[model samples]
Target chain A: MIPLSWYLILAAGLFCIGLFVVLTKKSAIGILIGIELMLNAVNINLAAFWHYYTQLNPSQTPLNGMVFLAIVFIVAAAETAVGLALIISAYRRRNTSVAGEMDLLKG
Target chain B: MTAMQIIFLIVAAVTLGGALMIATSRRMMHTVLWLVLTLMGVAVLFALLQANFFSVVQVLVYIGAIAILILFGVMLTRRSMVDAGESLVHKNWWVVAVVIALLFAAIVISIQPWGAAHTPLVELMEFKEPISDLGEALVDPAAYLIPFEVSSVLLLAVMVAAIYIAVDRKGGKS
Candidate 1:
């Protein structure tokens, strides 16, 4: 039987890697990828917790975790769409996809 | 170690390795490919956790829609497929690494004291059709209906917003 902490630790590592990519990557698309990874890590945490919670409380029907995760999926999809649109728009105007180079408002 | 534990370790390693590759891959196309690999590994983890619906959705939504969108973003943004001669990482990336390390340690320490953290999963019989329960819960008035409807509206708004933002506005100055 796999303990709950294993899932938590895996999520922590995934989230940290996402954070590293978000902070260090120079491309805006790379940052978007990091955000996706972080969201996935959060999804894993939610599912794992829900699994354990249902296990501990077998008498109750608690599907809230799955519902919440589904909502997150919606959010992730919406975010990716809007985010890539914004990136494309920025690239069109600024003529670059590098994050540091988009400093139009850096007066 | 047990077979389940061994499988978990292999999946975790593959997932983490793919994520690491996404961060380090030089070409935008290669990064997107790595993202696909990482997302697939995550989907497999979802299956291992017995969240089969999520595993399927992860593949359909994430890999099917999102990864392709990112690939299009890569293609539309760059004239060349490869990001040659460009520095991929920020100059102060070590600072970010130290901060992430501290964050990871903090998370591990915080999770250590939870009594539930050590507990193993219950038997499959205990679940009794969790997918159906999830479907019902989403539409149940007493449960997640509002959030579900709101997410639908959010998706509609996102579609409109994406189209508006990405449309090439010709002959417009400033």
Candidate 2:
């Protein structure tokens, strides 16, 4: 059987990768993708803790691991929609989608 | 190595490698593709964690739906794929260094408990009843009724918003 540490390590690694992507990627939608990755890493941690929680307290049943992840998923969808809408609107104004090219706010 | 260990390792590799490519890839479309692979690996890992319901939902909602919409958005907005670099700013190596540092700290903190002791795999298999239990809880007044209803409303709102944005205006030069 695989140990729980392995899952935690994986979550941490994925989280860091997502952070890197969000910081490095130039496109608006690409940053959204990075946010999704970070969300997935959070979900992984939640699921892992759910397993551990259940084992430690067998009588109570699992409380809120998957539930938390589900909520995060919904929020991610909402964020993507709003983000893409903003991106589309921005793109309509500026003829390019490159992240670095957007400097309209800079006076 | 055991089958479980091997499976975990493979999923880990895919998730991490796909994430790396997603971050570094120059092409926007290619980045989305890598994200899909990464999501699939994450779903597999969820299954390994014995969260079968979560695993299936991850595949259905994330892979089947959100990924498609994202790709659609990319296709609709971005210009034709150009090999020429289009990035606004060069990546800061310091960010990666910080991430690595944080990762190492997290691993160190997590190792104390995770490495100390472990329950056998059979015990974990028995707790698999959470799937059905979770379903029952979702509708139970004492359980997750509020959050469940809220999520449904949230999803509905997202659907309406996406449709409106996707169809409201078109042919704008960008």
Candidate 3:
């Protein structure tokens, strides 16, 4: 049987990977993907806690995690839409989507 | 091992693998394909967690809407959809070192057990009814009405901002 600790560890690993990607990648959409991955890690952690916590105790509703996760997911979607729009606009002006090339603000 | 656990493991593996591919891939189309797989895996994970409504929404909004928009951007901007993605980070190794340190810190914090705040888990008669409850909570006078409306407004603002920028690009306005 997979323990709750195992899920948490996996979630941690995924979160680290997402952070690394976000920090390293130059593409705006790529960073957005990393952000989504990080959000997924958080959602997984929440769901794992909900599952195990409910397993341990038998008096609380099991759907709290689901509800919270649903909200988070929606927020993530909204963030992605806005982020992509920015990316597209940037690409239109620069003719390239490379992150390092976007140095208009650099001194 | 319980079936749920087994299924969860499979979904996690798929999601992680897809995410890695998304990060490392150079081609734009390949990234979009990997994203689709990643989103699908996340949807399955949500289902396994009994968030059926969320699973549907994940598929509908993310896999359907956002992924398509990404591809659309790729096609509309570039002549071909297979440009080699540029590297953004400097050649210094210190960034990797810092990332590793931060990741270790996060893991340590997550694993620490200060005190166990216990709560009971009731056997819900309708695991699915919470979907309706959530819908009601979003609009109810005593619940999350403000947040719900605010989120919608935020989405609308994003939409307007997106259109403005896209059109401004054509008009040569910075």
Candidate 4:
């Protein structure tokens, strides 16, 4: 069994990279991809902890992490669907998918 | 090195490298491909942690569904399928590097003590199938029934909203 910390570190790395992409990407869909990456890191953490914690307490391994992870999967799929749909809608109106160009609500 | 350790290194490298490519790639197709690669790495990582169900979900949901959705979005929105110029916002590399370095350092330092008390694994894993437990938990009154029902409702609402927002009934041809 690998040390739990290694998984944690890897998740952290994935998250930071995602954050960088989110902060820097000009396209709205690119930002969405970054968010997916961050969510993936979170799922990794949840599963890794579940792995270790359940090992220590085999009698009482709560299914919350796994449940939450499954829920996240569903939510991510829905969000991606709606988000890209919105982006396409926005593209039709504004003729651009660039984040900076999406200033309709700007004061 | 142990087999697990070796697999870990390979998965982590692939994931991180793919993420880097996703961030830096100028073309949208490249970005989507890199995202797929990165998601696959994450799926392998889930398998490594013994969560075979999530690993499968990772592949099905992230790689199979989301990556294709992103590719379609990229293809549909852009006038040219190939976006030749820089698509990312011009960034100050030094500032981004400093932030990433700080974040990485904080995470590493915070987790350093956990390595000291690393628990050795039991020879045999007790629970083989977490998928069944998760299924039971979704419907079990004593468990997470509300959240499960709520997620379904949310999905329904999102589907409706996507149709509502995507369809141009008022402006364009129906």
RMSD of each: 2.4, 3.2, 4.0, 2.4
Q: lDDT of model 2 at residue A73? A: 81
The candidate that wins on TM-score is 1
Residue pairs clashing in model 2 are: A100-B88
Better of 1 and 2 by lDDT: 1
* Top candidate by DockQ: 1
Clashing pairs in 3: A57-B121, A58-B121, A59-B121, A59-B122, A60-B120, A60-B121, A60-B122
Winner by DockQ between candidate 4 and candidate 3: 4
By summed lDDT, which 10 consecutive residues of candidate 3 chain A come out lowest?
A57-66
Give the Å error, residue A27, model 2. 0.9
Worst 10 residues of 3 chain B by lDDT: B114-123
lDDT of 4 by residue, A1-107 (tens): 67777788889999999998888888899889989999889888888877777777778755867887788888889989999998988887777788877899531
lDDT of 4 at B145: 93
- Using Cα atoms with residue i matched to residue i, what is each candidate's TM-score against the true structure? 0.93, 0.85, 0.81, 0.92
Docking quality (DockQ) of candidate 1? 0.71
Q: What DockQ does each listed candidate score?
A: 0.71, 0.53, 0.40, 0.63
Among incorrect, acceptable, medium and high, the docking class of model 2 is medium
DockQ of 3: 0.40
- Candidate 1 wrong stretches, greater than 4 Å: A105-107, B80-84, B171-174
Fnat of the models, one by one?
Answer: 0.83, 0.49, 0.34, 0.66
